[model samples]
Target: MDQKIPYDDYQLPVVFLPSYESPPAWIPPQERIQHPDYNNELTQFLPRTVVLKKPPGAQLGFNIRGGKASQLGIFISKVVPDSDAHRAGLQEGDQVLSVNEVDFQDIEHSRAVEILKSAREILMRVRFFPYNYQRQKERTVH
Candidate 1:
């Protein structure tokens, strides 16, 4: 690692130019681009409900990973191709907020899995935060 030289040892002239004009007015939260549902119209609508009807003895067709029990909620890590979950439009990175109308916001991972496994038909509510892989790759490449 390169050593950082302290600027205090150098004798540099200080330039102080004060601005006369006032700062710009603070924009409302709804008018800002970062605010949800404000300037984001092209993205997918979040808090979407996906209904998956699983036949008897059939699998849910999705893999879940991450999130600590009773802490952070689990995520849909993978959605099997041509599966029930995929057919129902479940995407990766969907934060599983609830299962069968029961909120699992602070639910344990094992308990959440139990709840999901026990249900024949699942009514899952998910928050969709879009991820652009191509854009991310381009940024990383540069």
Candidate 2:
């Protein structure tokens, strides 16, 4: 006759398995979990290209902050309502990745301002990153 084991007295066997798995070789380094720049949060806000034409003697109607002085990447500080930038989908707190194919990710404030002002037709690659922008702003303020 088999005796029934009490539920409280029963023991479960512990199994040990490898916790890490190598990612596929085809995956790009940036997309890999182990990459330094890998950030799952950023995937949700994919970079988008915004094309705008500046009317003669007219401002783009947007303000930009960040750069070497701020120790932050270029970010849109403001976007005027019904402006060219606003109509083109540019929003405040959006990070500017590049302008006219020129990397704005790491640039000087004056240089960035010059680039934006000099270009009549702008092609910018940007992504919404309000959290980062806010943190950077706070850091610069203090």
Q: Please give the lDDT score at residue 62 for candidate 1.
A: 92
Please give the lDDT score for candidate 1: 0.70
Tens-place lDDT digits, model 2, residues 22-108: 875576755677765456565647899999998778898899888876667889988999998999999988999999999998898
Query: lDDT of all the models against the reference?
Result: 0.70, 0.85
Off by over 4 Å in 2: 1-44
**Model 1: how far residue 32 lies from native, Å:** 13
Which residue pairs does candidate 1 place in steric collision? none
The TM-score obtained by model 1 is: 0.59
Cα lDDT tens digits, model 1, 43-98, are 46568888987778889999765445324456777899999899888887677778
Candidates' RMSD to native: 9.8, 11.3
Off by over 4 Å in 1: 1-45, 130-142
User: Would you estimate the TM-scores of all the predictions?
Assistant: 0.59, 0.66
